[model samples]
Target: MIAHSVDDPLYYLHNFRQVLLWVEQRYADLLDPHELAFMQAFAGLDAPAQALMVRMVMRKGELFRSDRLEYTEIGDTCSALQSLEALGWVREPEQLSLEQLFALLRKDELASGFAGLLSRPRAAKSDLLSQLQALAPAPRPLSEWFAQAPVRIVQWCLQPLCDRMRLLFFGNLYQDWSEFVLADLGLLRFEQVPFSPGSRALQQRSEVDLALALHQCAERLEQGERPGSIVQALAGWHSDNPWLARRHGRLLFALGQQCERLGEWDLALAVYAQSSHAQARIRQVRVLERSERWQQAHALAVQLAEAPANPLEVQALQRVLPRLVRKLGGPAQPRRRARPAPVIELELPREHAALGVEEAVRQHLAQAGGEVHYVENTLFNSLFGLLCWDAIFAPVPGAFFNPFQAAPQDLHDCDFQARRAAQFDACLGRLDDGTHHQAILDRYAAKQGLQSPFVFWPMLSDALLTQALACLPAAHLKHCFLRLLQDIRNNRAGMPDLIQFWPEQGLYRMVEVKGPGDRLQDNQLRWLEFCAEHGLPVAVCHVRWSEAA
Candidate 1:
């Protein structure tokens, strides 16, 4: 694991280029003549321009806010956009600034719910258009245009056709991409660095240059490319910084995983030894066993079985551990971690297309006025939170970001941790003063104008806030808040659903509604146990439908 510098935009751009170039070749025959012609023209473009096109298409697809493509920052204003327009496969309104662009979008209904932005205010005046025209004489970046306006601008770029194309061709890559981008040193947060020498140098060496190159080697090993090239390049990566080395560990793990998949046992073991990835130890044991190093594999397997650090790793290792133990003539007793006690999961059986169980629960809660909200993961993960750690971060300056995934590469960075703690403290102060309720609601309202599901959930009402505050213990708040502060991606789930708040009595209970046979998922079970431990009011309501006789 090499400790590369943090300002590595090339790392992301490398990936951006690789995916496009690979797709262009892989899907060549599938392209219509016009699409083929388009690719040819795309191929003719210089690397920077090509990367820009891919970035736009990869992010927003064929359709997006025209303003986002305008790059007046570096003589890039609308030139690349015009080239795409020349392809006739791309499109935009006559204007680039959103005042006119959104107006155009709304007039045509090009984007669903985009009209909502037309209705959002600016400085207490009517909608943002008039305010935008007044604030700046010309169209700039959407973020700048709406600098004073209260509306979400980040989601304005969307490509409908390109999105479908991705789902059609690259479905398997989606999870892998998410896994990579959602991690600490992944592409998403690392590319936010502005155009500069430092960014340019690393941007060229993106994940594709590193990880994808290794992937291609593993994939085509039989077809002739030497794994030695990859090993040589990997071994050459050197860094004294432990933080950077940890970041590179992911890259090493990716290579080891590929080697293991390709049946390169010795190479896989060598790669795994240097990696501190969660599954690295178990993976090494597998390779060692495959090589018939029975004694060494047995010793490592015994140590892992006795005390595994990663649950998923243990689950995977357990399947093979018993066999290895028997061969080694070891005792059958495995010192497994104690499992959580069972919580009976209730289910509500379907009633043949009648009112759905969820709707029925909603109606039941509504009977008493402001009793229940069907706030699932979408709401709890988004609206109810004080800080939007999911979309925003305040780590040390010069930290890069991924334009694709909405979070940073490494939330675990010591600098990020310290800054996030301070940010969280500020949010807590607002919460105590009752200011956070409205501030959070305002964030939701601002996002209402955008094209994201995160903004469209049930509104965070004042009554809900008051009732929630009454029932929520400080410890629970601290736990959840700190979890979000630390890692928004993993900690966002596991929340109880259908929180029924009684504003009259300033009380609430988390009601998990289920049909006659539905079961609790691991995350749901975790929530129930947390509630149980915390002494919070929670119930798993089960509904049984009568026969239609």
Candidate 2:
């Protein structure tokens, strides 16, 4: 891997070349003919051409003006564009639409180009576009639109091909070439997990095509496309790959939610029924209930409650089952109530309102003998991340495919802990033998600044780590870690807002602060119950601001 610096003129080109090399080495078997040809052709290009190609690909839009393609390293833009144009990778478009033209041109340029057509030359760019669009002018090349304009517009034709390469390298469309620059600049750092020979995010070419197709469907849905249309389009596509299957299910789930928002209950039910997402069934039940299909909702709710998917589902079921029973005219079932956390009431000065509720509470609770820090979910998660660093980063197949991942791909999967049971057991074993303290401290020191899913490095300090380790019991840590392993996606959040520690007394208390008119959220309620069950000292601090006399 090549490290990039601000002084390096060709840093982006280096990054693009690294991605190409990585894809060629790992995904050679999966690459199609066009992609393969692109790799070969790109490799054979001259330095200036390669740099110019990368600059366009890394940029925001496909359309580029000749005047704007300026680079000091690549001496002549026109000269560099020759090889690219010859290969048909970049070329002048046959015609540019009104919208495309408006996007490419500045206000001054638009006024100059269409001086005769504009009703008001002094109007804003938006008004100019509206005026021109109302005329319904035919699309034409820049040369025809503005004969006197010096700049020529050319569109990069190879964006889709380049996007496919990027997708293969990053495993998703959200992360792009900027990751390389961020890593190079020391703005972001990722753990180095050794990849096995078979470590690939997508095993088959069909999976790659399916992933891209699914992404397009998601974009269409977001753009207000009908849920039924998207559902119909998704009907024929299916993937045996778990990762792809998960993506498919999530997309369907999102579409289902959108349908619900639009009051299309039947469509919501239809979409949810086809989805394999964990919460899809519950959503289906909710939709059925809303649509007045009480019997069906009751039946499905009963089925799910018999063997819930996870704690979150169980929690949902507990809330919905009683109402569903009443709606169906069934016998009333006893509602199980969560044990309430101890409460602390306080009336503080209104002048401290600027500090925010959590901070104000922390300040009020701070004493000479005790310290209060607004840790929220960071402290426990960080400790677990540090102690279980090896287990989390263990080179499991499919867990890690690329070098830039902050966490394993399967971190939220149901079998995440099951697959690495022995490793996690070893990590958690240190707690039982009283070695966890030293292990956490050592890991914190060594792995500081390296990205981890749980550790918030900026908020965590040596003093806090020392105080926490001294005050927090190992048993409590074990319980929290075990719960986190149960359902990492949901269980890792909803911790109390502040923690009060007394190093001298070797005691600590977690506090959840709620200001006037505020209430506990479901996740926060679950955490408080968990703490109560495990005999952990935690409290709910309700704060009210005093009125001025």
Candidate 3:
């Protein structure tokens, strides 16, 4: 015989007395103390007796399935029934019933009535046949059960029978499973089952298995179908399967145009955003384009261009390449120049070019590894161009920015006009020192339509110098410097340059104010050389880089 051990609380109750008490409290009516004890004894009598013990217990209720017992053993059930009778507990209540038990409890005189009253009469062989026959022809369909019965009845019957009910409403509905019926039943919603020993144990096991299954599903998705399948999966599940939201979003993106064909535009748009692939973004742009929303499409396209390109996204873009080319003015033809490198003598669009002088100075400086000290509206370009070479060749060791600090008089005059001229003179003056003479000479030659030895260069070459030179004569340089200070004082333009140093890296320095790119007149070059010969490292620092969003 296998060793019997009580693993549960029920196992601890050794006597019929205690088992009967448990059953009484547990159910309406079933085991009596003496019958329970006899069953326990019968359990000890080897394999043959164990089968009898089980039947004795089954006599008390309608048997469904129970822990393993061989009901087929010959005469096993009979022996157990006889044991019950011998104990004077479960009697053959010949025609006796529930009414008799009630009557006796009310009377209290018929103690013997208690034993027999508790036992129900055995069913006749003919009655069993009738019951089986009745059930055979009337097999109930689930549809009728759901439609005819109250919703509450189904909810109560289903109620996630175990913690690991392995079912979701929507997912099941997609497959025409009864989960939809469960969800449709009006009732309180719950994220997890309420606390109960059986429920908790079952839930723990169920959740573990669910997590594993989802992981496997994810792996399968990577190996098999495209994202649409995942979306379809998510769309089917109920609230109980809350994990599908993100997966659904990805699928919506993958399904792409087919979804639009299916009239699932909203779902597609949502997936485009949620998906990991950049293709989704391109799809969004296409959707907007197809709708003829030009501005929105343009903005989205720009955003797409800014992002790092990926193959799928590239494919998406290629699909709409013709449309993009058409919208952006037809494939960007290169413009030919009448003159290769124009000189600074002509005053062409001075105001328009002048407006961007400060930006020009900043860009030149950034490329040259220098900083813009101050930009005014005069001779600043010459100074700026010279410093750009110095910075590119010999950059400073550290970073410092002091564009606004200036002498009181200079600070009072940095208005747009004042700054342009001042900057023009400052640029010319610094370059004349001959330290950057070779580069400056090359640059000046380039301005005179000479090509550089270097193969390629940015298109904005000489833009800073030419604009500044066009803004002035010496008189204007001085006038603008003074006016620049006034503008600074009045808050029209920013503050002026007060720093006096080699814009590159040196201890001794001098004040150098930048001027607008359009003010670099002829005399400004001579004045700049004179300043350069006198040991003042005066120059304008054209910037080439600045903060971006």
Instruction: Tell me the deviation in Å of residue 540 in model 3.
Output: 56
Higher-lDDT candidate among 2 and 3? 2
TM-score of each: 0.49, 0.89, 0.21
For residue 21, what is the lDDT in candidate 1? 56
lDDT for each of the candidates? 0.52, 0.88, 0.35
Better of 2 and 3 by TM-score: 2
Each candidate's number of clashing pairs is 22, 0, 79
The Cα error of candidate 3 at residue 221, in Å, is: 17
Question: Which has the better TM-score: candidate 1, or candidate 2?
Answer: 2
Lowest summed lDDT over 10 consecutive residues: which window, candidate 1?
199-208
* Ten residues in sequence with the least summed lDDT for candidate 2: 179-188
Candidate 2, number of clashes: 0
Predicted candidate 1 versus true structure: per-residue lDDT over 387-442, tens digit per residue: 35323444332233222323344544333455445665676566466566567666
Stretches > 4 Å off in candidate 1: 1-229, 240-247, 263-266, 276-354, 364-370, 383-385, 388-391, 395-405, 411-421, 424-471, 485-488, 513-518, 541-545
Q: Could you say which candidate leads in lDDT?
A: 2
Evaluation by lDDT, superior candidate among 1 and 2: 2
lDDT of 2 by residue, 1-549 (tens): 655775788888887888898888888998889889998999899999999999999898899888899999988878889999999999999898889888888999899878898889989999999999999989987778888855788999988888888888777777768766776655667788876566666888888898899989988998999888999898888677877877888898999999999999988998898887768888988998888898999899999989887778888889888998898788998989999889999998998888999999998899435989999999999999999999999987667766777898788877789878999999999999999999998998888899999899999998999999999999999999999998898889899999999999999999999999999988888888899899999999999999998
